[model samples]
Target: MWGGCWPAGPLRRSAFTRRLSVPISAPEALLTVRGLEAGYGKIGVLHGVDLHIAAGEVVTLLGPNGAGKTSLLRALSGLLPWSGGSARFGGLELRGVGPREAAQAGLVHVIEGHRVFTQISVTDNLLLAGYDLPRAERMARVEEALSFFPEIAAKRHEKGGALSGGQQQMLAVAQGLVRRPRLLMLDEPSAGLSPVLVDRVLNVVRELQARGTAVLLVEQLIEKALGAADRVYALAQGRIVLEAATSEADLPRRLERAYFGDDAVSPLEA
Candidate 1:
């Protein structure tokens, strides 16, 4: 079923593809990073990475495995501390900010994998996301988030372990939505999901964009990622190699060259 959703053929354009003709300028960007670097003890992963995401824009980050995509997201969301450089979200400095502070500042990271607690009820899991809120506001936020995923809303009382893999993924995303973040960083939401379920998850990016929420997505599905984004950034060896508007022509060829270096042959020429 997963194979059918993402086949080795020409790319399938997503129904939610953006039609923007011009890229967002840096001055209006919602998130900005300059010369950012981070890694686990004694090892460096990201090297002088510079990137920006405009308000309400969907920007997809693509690269082969070990491209530091996950590391970049972790650094931005305060999961991994930045060792050098600087980052600013909504004009506030990000250094020394922790995960909870990042979320409270309207920058939420929905980490890869279906990470919900199996023993907890679906609604309870969402409630935990808003645990710091007042009683009434927390309940209201939970209801607002459930509105986006009727599949899980119908199973609100069920333990997270009882849901299928797809539903669990939805619940994880819903957990992020409970905060109503201004900028959501999704680290491969499509991982391990069937194509149908992948589409269901990507569709939420569209809904979020329509409501003026910006997203920085790191995904493995090239076609789907490009389809859902207004711009694309390719990271290789812990650095950004390519940045282009999704509407540009010959993107596959450009992406190939970016991934394999300038010497790579375009599919058309080959």
Candidate 2:
């Protein structure tokens, strides 16, 4: 049977910090998914997804709009119904779990679009994310999240709606960290932000990885995603058409292949 909640213990720590003792050895896989399928109603979006991420790896999922990237993430986070497949994190089955249970399972999905409570104070919004956690631990995690985004920290007393778009986006991410999840899944984090704010958000993601949190990021900025991720998966029409590594030097060609297949001809050719 699957575990009842997302994390089995208190404020689940990032697995990245645990392997520092054996620096020479490779980190173990923290999450794995196979043959995953899900959708809204009868229209299937994800058609047998397969993926895995090591304890400290930054794996980005790239795709055009409506290619099922968000659907796949929702399935992983238990926000959507799964038709079939296995999702395992740290050896636990996540087939029928709910989103809250997934969060406790150390797999936190920071949804796209700022979903902060409009009427609530910034601190209060964060408090809601960790209401299940003990007070002291919750406080600690909130502080840690605030440290990553000084803009949010300064506006902790302000209502969520009062913050700028960039600041609200920062809060959305901060709210996800109170549980101290091992795998942080982000969707279109750079959407609607200025280039400078986008860099700030990406920097936070890098810091999270540095602190040993595995990241499954869905970003549109090809260069930024490639720069931050060790491996990249590009989904086209509900399928992963290509995957490549940053060290491969032929990354441009790889991306081209993923975006437009080799057989695709230029307009002039037609």
Candidate 3:
């Protein structure tokens, strides 16, 4: 996020990390997934999966492509039906739940593509997400979400499709924020973003955690993910292969070693 091109080495501490006085630690699970299995008909993506995200924590899911990271989010958000196991967000079980029900229950999934009402204005897009609320409360929520994404706030009157990709991505997150999620699941939130905008968006993730929203992130930017993660779970071939605290002395090394059986593969190379 500095002025120059992104550094080639592993991600270093940011000013955001230093600003916090206390370290975030693991808490009781706000979301609990056990033996989760999901896939298209006759195909399976998650295999006996087990994962948890504590209240107000940021947990990142990492892995190479086709590792079922997106599938995990989809399953949790109730976009895909589950074959076995349960995912509990607070007291509600996700199995058999619909996408709108999941969101209403405070489980918001901002999927990878940053889907929005392209033909509508940015403000209208956010308003659509809060349609269940009264107009007065809806406007308040919209304003609060805009505060987190000032770029979109500046273009509030423009069509959602007119914004650049990064701005649209921000608007997608802002839409989710208006829901005041108990657990926010993001799939590749930084994909295709410029380095600076990537930094900005990830900063919002960290900030959201500080403000008491638990986050479940699936990211390809391993270093950036680790830098902001409280705990991390790495998936490979549809199963969780590695789990560690972000504070581990050699996290990237251990993650790669767990994935490839070679300590030589730094996350920077991924």
The per-model lDDT (C-alpha) reads 0.84, 0.79, 0.83
**lDDT of candidate 3 over 76-146, digit per residue (tens):** 88889899998888999889999999999999999998799999999999999999999999999999999
> Which residue pairs of candidate 1 clash?
none
Q: Which residue pairs overlap in candidate 2's backbone?
A: 6-104, 6-105, 7-104, 7-105, 16-212
Give the range of the ten consecutive residues with the poorest summed lDDT in model 2: 2-11
Compare candidates 2 and 3 on lDDT and give the better one: 3
Could you estimate the TM-score for every candidate?
0.89, 0.86, 0.89
What candidate 2 gets wrong by more than 4 Å, as runs, is: 1-27, 263-270
| Candidate 3 ranges with C-alpha deviation above 4 Å | 1-26
Model 1 TM-score, all chains together: 0.89
Instruction: For residues 1-270, write the lDDT of model 1, one tens digit per residue.
Output: 222122222221221132212334655888998999898988999988888988999999986677789999999989998889998999789977999999999999999999999999999999999999998999999999899889999999999999999999999999999999999999999988889999999999999999999999998777788889999887766777777888888786776555443465443334
Residue pairs with backbone atoms closer than 3 Å in model 3 (clashes): none
Candidate 2 matches the true fold with a TM-score of 0.86
| Local accuracy of candidate 2 as per-residue lDDT tens digits, 1-270 | 111101112211231112111112225779878888889999999877777789978998876667788998999898999998898889779889999888998999999999899999999999889999889888888898899999889999999999999999999999988878899999988888988998999998899899999999998776777778888776765666666666676666545444554453221122
